[model samples]
Target: MTILYMLLSSLEITDISEQELELIEPLESKFPIDKIKVTVCCQSSFICFRFYVLSSRYKWMTYKEAATARTAIGCGLIHHGILKGSCIALYFINRPEWLIVDHACAVYSLISVPLYDTLGPDAVKYIINHADLKAVFCMPLTLNSLLSILSEIPSLRLIVVVGGMENEVPLLPSSTSVQVVTYSQLLSQGRSNLHPFCQPKPDDVATVCYTSGTTGTPKGVVLTHGNLIANASGFTISVKFNLSDVYISNLPLAHIFERFDHISLAHFGVAVGFYQGDTMKLIDDFADKETPSKGVFCKSNFKHVCRAEYI
Candidate 1:
């Protein structure tokens, strides 16, 4: 079966009427109605894999699982007093957990500051310090480099590791005062002590992305929740991806192009698969017979694959 067929047939999702789908604001009004579907996608026996994290395969998450994770991360943030409008850094690559934390941030109405995983220590330090980030949801790849400049970023207090355990926490400088917590632990705390979801205003800043600092200091670009919704809505109407569409998300989420597409695809409830890091293996993933019609590939790789008809 095709990836789109697998998603629609196996999962139970309420179809958003055309009227409701056209609504400009994603989270509308003072008391937001829960019309937005959290039950986007889930694991089924049909699909081979949902997320290829490096070489490992992770099954898809159901709506309930996604909601639970949302509550868990939101509650964990709240418990630590990371309230609405607070700035936090999402320093990781393209992974399933990245999207979970993103949804959780939206739940709490917290501002997200996305950092490239491959950023240099100076760039990392500059962004953290400039944003005055107090918390960060990161992975080992970025965390290791971040730790080197942790002392310089005094505003940062919490390091929520997305994939690693507390035991695996690296040693910090004696002067650095930062608390490390595992992602699962945060989810546990959130699950037990669920907090009320905060409604975000259209103008509320959803994320702050930094530009590549080729010349000097990186420039920060602020995008509001409304901006994101508008872009996603536009993309949906323009691209029109359906349930049967299977998409491969392999580009860096830190970039606006990739990030916007991911958010847009989620709104459409299309199945998205994350690519494993190796470009050599990427051909194998897309070349598979079951690979669907739709996929977002990197611009850099476009030239090489332009001759291939499957793309």
Candidate 2:
């Protein structure tokens, strides 16, 4: 029976070797026959683990579970499923079109909406005021935009943004009644026991994205874990895979494309570096050898050095 389960588990996963698959198929077959027939679909949510937590020092931050150890994020994603060590991952692109098709293949529950990039404060306020938004996970810029109008919408309860900063921003009259947290901090705060990284469940509505409307009012799209996982798996298959490198994530993570590929790539053993806001200023230094530039200031005593003729 032990050998049978091993053989069965291998067959359920498509990426394994034929011999390995053959050896493990029977073992896995013992599982619910219905489960056996069910294909293991990686949805956008399952494809990547994008949320992060800041370290104790808070100078730098990584995924909620990363602690000091960096990872190839995709590798981390499938670590339970396949790989041995935790991997680092990063996200930059944010395209729902790419996320939708793949999302369909994995979990099949997709009610996704694109949070509008161009919507005004009024529109954002309206969405938060009316929509039954359970939670909001966003990047730094979007978070800022939302904060501006939070007072306008009293219905909003929680805001979960992605990155960390030296100081927490002042929300709701400099310091009123608005809960603010980064993705990493939220996980850390929410953890009940030793396990630091626990994502929201599959059935929970994952996101409430408001599309950027050019003509009509922006509409919110609701997404689930299944939808996200499907997007993630399809994205993993398209990239040129190699786990030893780092990916630059400049695009808005709120978009599924960045979130999916970033998480999927991590499973493949790639590390991700998230340069703040605009990536253009970052020195094009991905090579392991490039020394990070240290901030420096120069000061010289002008009169003493020049021997000023006074007197």
Winning candidate number (lDDT) = 1
What is the lDDT of every predicted structure here? 0.63, 0.36
What is candidate 1's TM-score against the reference? 0.76
- Give the per-residue Cα lDDT of candidate 2 at 198: 24
Best by TM-score: 1
The TM-scores, one per candidate, come to: 0.76, 0.46
lDDT for model 2: 0.36
Q: Which ten residues in a row have the lowest lDDT in candidate 1?
A: 299-308
Those runs of model 2 whose alpha carbons end farther than 4 Å from true positions after fitting are 1-64, 67-119, 134-151, 159-177, 180-188, 191-204, 237-240, 279-311
> What would the per-residue lDDT of candidate 2 be over residues 194-251, giving only the tens digit for each residue?
2122222445454455555555676666665545545554554555544334455555
Q: Which lDDT value does model 2 have at 247?
A: 54
TM value for model 2: 0.46
Worst 10 residues of 2 by lDDT: 302-311
Q: After superposition, how far is residue 135 of candidate 1 from its true place, in Å?
A: 1.0
